[model samples]
Target chain A: MQKIVPNISVDCVIFGFDFKQLNVLLVERKLQDEKTGETLIDDWTLTGYHIFEDEDFDTAAARILKGLSGLDNIYLEQFYAFGKVSRVDSPKDNIWLKHQHEGFSSRIVTVGYYSLIDNSTVTLQLQERNVKWFSITDLPELGFDHQEILNKALEKLRSKLRSEPIGFELLPEKFTLSQLQKLYEAILGTTYDRRNFRKKVLQMKYIIPLNEKQKAVKHKPAQLFIFSRDVYERTKRERFDFSI
Target chain B: MQKIVPNISVDCVIFGFDFKQLNVLLVERKLQDEKTGETLIDDWTLTGYHIFEDEDFDTAAARILKGLSGLDNIYLEQFYAFGKVSRVDSPKDNIWLKHQHEGFSSRIVTVGYYSLIDNSTVTLQLQERNVKWFSITDLPELGFDHQEILNKALEKLRSKLRSEPIGFELLPEKFTLSQLQKLYEAILGTTYDRRNFRKKVLQMKYIIPLNEKQKAVKHKPAQLFIFSRDVYERTKRERFDFSI
Candidate 1:
């Protein structure tokens, strides 16, 4: 009797911020058409994989992240699953499917996870040939419903930012309130009254104002601030509301 | 060259309320020990599978739900991905490793989604033997890391309940304030201040008061109310702060 096998896998769309715009990492596909034995034009996509039998889903995502980006110990959170029947346009067009003797089309049920990382920490590895970063706003036409995945990930990231101190991950260790507000505005896709935003931030008492000031801005320099990691940890662990 | 197969699949844990406690649907695993060639005694688990090449992930989940419980059109949402190394204990005892030809030890990654369904809608399919509902608080040891997955799903559900109007799915069409409170308390795993909770619910203006009163309760009969689906949809779509 044939033993049952599970066909499942995890994919990660690593999103990074450079204080200006949102960006995502993508890898170019090298698959060819099976029937015509013709190499298909290269198309960029997210780094992904088939879940190894011995590995956990998270481990697979981490491995892909490390393998493609050469970065580890970064925060990765699963956001959504793409299971639309027509997710992949044609099953027989890919090189991966051509190798299977069973002649079955590829039905990929991918769980998309987004990671927030400071762009400076990212160093390309073997992915240099196949991977590149595209601004979330100026994305090239993608192959799959990756655009939808990115949108959902952005929504989750915004929700996370509202409730947690995850925005700190997108910024330098020390920054100004102006920079902080800019980051929030970028993520929220809307502007907030600077005075109100600052007042709200100060009331939270989670961002400690530093004695230093930013040196390079053209206007009056703003005071620097660092996230109160201790307070954030305590409040987050206790489930305190951080909504603004 | 051997063809690489892209397999798709879905796994679901159906949660139901049993009047006094929350419960989950589970089934038994039929696989035997690989190395010892001995059947493992009484290992129960969640319903899952590999997706057909032509099917979507949501369709696969729906199919699994129907196949296992004979329920259709239930409210199911994709939750977190369970990906950790050793999520499935590998290194099948030495005996199973010896029969390498079987490939039973190949890695499988599963995407876990969950649903909240009224217990009355459950119609078990005779195809499954030993199918039963276990109280979420009193679950037996499950296969793999399913217990952990179930816990994460519950946490997600709780968080979702606070942000979204998912309570409508769990409660009957017409429910008393006390019944609504109990449902919230059960999912949140906390004791809510009844007066304060009621105050907040009423302030939302999304609960339509009815003339009918709940019968047979020990306290004074509570007024019945139905959720305003239109208001809920408008509020949710407008992205108003729904934090309670």
Candidate 2:
């Protein structure tokens, strides 16, 4: 029997980029009436579960992610902790909780974790559960304040993508400047001047240019660039200004 | 009687700038032997308490800050959540926990909140609890995992100070360039070239120079400047790069 911490839980918002738009991985939550054998409620929610009493939060989040996706060593980060008393106030959420646990607590504090994965790299083994990636702009009505959670996660992701080089996690190893521009545009929901964007990115010491070009494409082959994290760590100076 | 959540607690790392160095607010945790009435352990820890079930995390953090400082609307930010099972493994911490609550849970997940205050602007009202400000460099062995919590809070503060204009929170409304430079130096633990630093700051349009000058100083009266948050908010653009 798993000893669950009654008041604490963990939720993961896995983000993926497929070169066109930014999407979030969500799991379909379906609850059926025990006695009548009928579907009571069905909705979408982020992948999550109650943390075990003996496990730490990071371990719990990793365990849940691996169980859902069968992937390890992904880019995971803890963004925020949502502790509103009415977070699970929806009737359907309450019903689902009641069915899942006996005498569930009225309040739960959920720690939010977000992970990034390359859309084309690995196969997600989520076939058993109805898991799918939904575009951020066209998300369905998520269950139990998960919409707010997802929104917060997106906000964190946007702020982080602007400053950090974590966006490479969602892109292929060898990528073109256009693909990189598309990624920034997709996540930030804005367009950048191609000339100015390329100039700025090219000036960055960590963005190393490669000798190879795109192998197969309809358009003219573009030069590929690789992000050198080692060079970034070695040559990075203490940043004095953040108002980039 | 106060209703408390056994497993969820909030720890506050209150940072104050005294113009020379960074200091953290700590409460002296003195435990006395029950039968002998002799002081067994005396040490310092951050000001914190278990959150009430009725309120949210922000509300709980604010309430704790207000109760300790008798001040409201100070600059408070939630940085990280510490959920390690062995956070309170020390014998002194365990003894204090046993003295405070009946049958306390073995595991506690503490949300870390950090706040900044100008040391000269307001007087702290923590005399009853023996709370005092200790310099970050010169500190005693803190009880529990408070030292780790304080270090994380400082890391967050350092990171936030570089990218955001939050360093002004520790300065007086009217300050000279030297004072501003000193403020940054104290927090960042590094000295900036005077001419270069001034050049960078002057280029920022939001840092408005006032006609007023310093009064009653030994050296020549330097020009005064105020951080124009209104102008900063109005003219702020979406940042594209974070690598300063």
Candidate 3:
């Protein structure tokens, strides 16, 4: 028997960028009436599970993410904790949750953990649970206050992106500056002056320009640049800010 | 019959500054032998409690702070959550905790909340709890992973002090640039070039200079300046970064 903390859970909000739009990984859950064989609830929710008795919150979040993506050492962060009393009180979620957990009748305080991933980097292996990535702007009606959780995670991501180098987590190892700008625009939901944005970002010494360009494209291949973590680590005194 | 969540708690690390040093608010707990009436254990810990089932994490933190300080609308933020399996398993803390609660036998995951206050602003009224301010550098042995929690909160405060104007939370409404510099030095545990520090901070338009001067001082009194949140709010687009 798997012992778990019945009143606490860790919800992992995996955000991925496919070089176009920002998306979040969610799982589809469908509950059917046992006696009448009718669909009672069919909705999407964040990937989460009750934390094990022996696991800390971070460990629980990592375990859940690793189980879904089969990847290790992803950039995971615990952003917020959602503990609204009526968060899980919806009749549909209450009925659906009964089919999932053995004893989950009480309120659950879920620690919200999020990560940014380049969609091509990881091989998602939870198709059996119907895990799919939904564009952040066109999200379905999520269950159990997960929409609020995702919004909070996006807000945090936006704030961190302004002062941190976390936006590279959503890009390939070698990316063009246009790709970087697009990723920022998608997450922040705003457009930036191309010249101004590039001027400010290129000043950061850590964005090392590689003597390389795109392989194949319809337009002119822009120069490629790699975010040098080594350079950043060496000169960590410099604050990474691109509020332009 | 005060019902609470037995396995979840909120710990508040209240940080205050008195223009000389940074301090943390702590409460003392003592355990005594039942028959002999001899003291078994005595130690300091953060002000916290097992959360009520009806309360959210932020609400619980604010309630605990208000109950202790009798102050409303102080700056409070949820920093991190400490959920180690052995966090509350210390034999000494376990013995002392038994007297405080009816059933706290299981592992408790505590969400760490922190706040900054000007020592002169609030009237602390928890004399009976042996609540006192201790300098961060010279702290007593804290109980049950609280030392680790305090260390983490200090680290967060240091990082925030670098990029945000949260340092103003520790000063009086009208303060000199020298006082602001001293507050930053005390929190970041370093000294700065006086000329450079003032030059950088003076450029921030939000720090408005008033036609006022300090009074009742032995030496030459400096000019007084107030942190204009109105100006900050009006031109909030400018990122507040004081890495100098």
Candidate 4:
């Protein structure tokens, strides 16, 4: 076997939005201890893997994400590197990993990445016993400080959403203003004033109004709008302030 | 012997502002090849070290900075992880590290961090051969991927400056409005309208003016001011718009 690059692993925090709520992709693992030979079943973790010797850092992350989800062209961004000695070297991870894989006999430093995708666009073939999407609010204790990794990813997402229109990635091709508002509310966990929120949206010329409306709806059908990245690139105001 | 955590390192990108320009912290390295006995000298790199077992990632980074520069209270922030497999696997670096350090026989995944400090506040006793501050613009080609790491760190610093009061860290305890403006212009690499810049700054309640002036100066002295963190924390507006 090709010797794995020692002490380096890639973990991905995949954020999915299903219109009303936020979700994260997690993989379930089961292993036996190296020292005690005790078995571990159904332990949940963020989708992660060891980096191959010939791969770039980003390519390694993209490889794991594509292999598991079978999806491509997803927007992935590196958020942080977690290198606390015990992050993987703790007794629990040490024994579990040592027994399962020979290459994992030493301390491992993991690079953390967060990917954003619309939950409705892709289907997950692995579930129950393997991989699943967990709501951002509720999650089980993860293996090897993955909980902290997910927390940091969410923080980056929230901060990025405020300044840029990245939330459009978590949205559909065409969506109503209310649907767009709900997406932001779900991700940010805050309510916005309807008037001000619309004012902000209306001011953004890149959010092009399309001649489409929700079909077969019992309530009033709202007009749909699409995000024009070209327009946004040409006209976004990036004036930074030092009031703070 | 207590073994170092194998294949994981932390590199610090310390950015210092000396009123007129930006400077970065660097350390010189001298190593000999394990195979050919070829000696490499006068190569510059970021202050970095492998993480010690039983230490936190942030704590390890802090320890490295403190140990190298004797600066304990500097503001350090994790920016990214450079995990391209060949980042340290190039034959030149591989043999050099192998001969000098046992813990680095395998691959290295380096975490990059950037620290901000006022240049006037520091007293560098490290003379010619060990450590020194080089202006960010006039930096030589650094060893390994340190140049890429430094570029990434500056990108982060610029983005953070847009939304937060982090640039204050690069300024002295007391400074004139012109000095503060120059700091922003230098860091952002752009010029601003004097009236607009002053208006935006004067509108900030946190930028408090004092009855202080330059004791000795050739030109007319400008009034001095201080940044009030408490006022800023309580009153800063952080509404981000995307009208572009």
Query: Global lDDT of each model?
Result: 0.69, 0.86, 0.84, 0.79
Clashing pairs in 4: A235-B244, A236-B244
Which sections of candidate 2 miss by over 4 Å?
A31-40, A125-128, A203-205, A209-211, A242-244, B32-40, B203-205, B242-244
Clashes of each: 12, 1, 0, 2
How do the residues B213-236 of candidate 1 rate in per-residue lDDT, one tens digit apiece? 988879888899998878766664
**Candidate 3 displacement at residue A201 in angstroms:** 4.7
lDDT of 2 by residue, B95-159 (tens): 88878776568899999999988876776656567878898989987989999999999988887
lDDT of 3 by residue, B179-225 (tens): 98888878878877889877776777899999999999899999999
The TM-scores that each candidate's chain B achieves against the reference are: 0.79, 0.92, 0.93, 0.90
Best by lDDT: 2
Q: In terms of TM-score, which candidate is stronger, 1 or 2?
A: 2
lDDT of 4 by residue, B114-230 (tens): 988887777554444477789887997587778889999998888788778888888888898888888888888888888888888988899999999966879999889899999
DockQ, per model, reads: 0.26, 0.51, 0.33, 0.51
- lDDT, candidate 4, residue A194? 81
lDDT of 1 at A87: 68
> What is the per-residue lDDT of model 4 for residues A1-244, given as tens digits with 9 covering 90 to 100?
5546766788899888887888998877777545898775446788887787777789988888788678888889999888766676456666567657665745577888899887887866554447788888888768878888889999888878877788888878888888888888888888888888888899889999999898888999999999999998898766675535
Model 4 ranges with Cα > 4 A deviation: A28-43, A88-103, A127-130, B28-43, B88-103, B125-130, B242-244
RMSD of 2: 2.7
* TM-score for each model: 0.80, 0.91, 0.89, 0.86
The alpha-carbon lDDT assigned to residue B169 of candidate 2 equals 77
For each candidate in turn, the interface RMSD (Å) is 5.6, 2.7, 5.6, 2.4
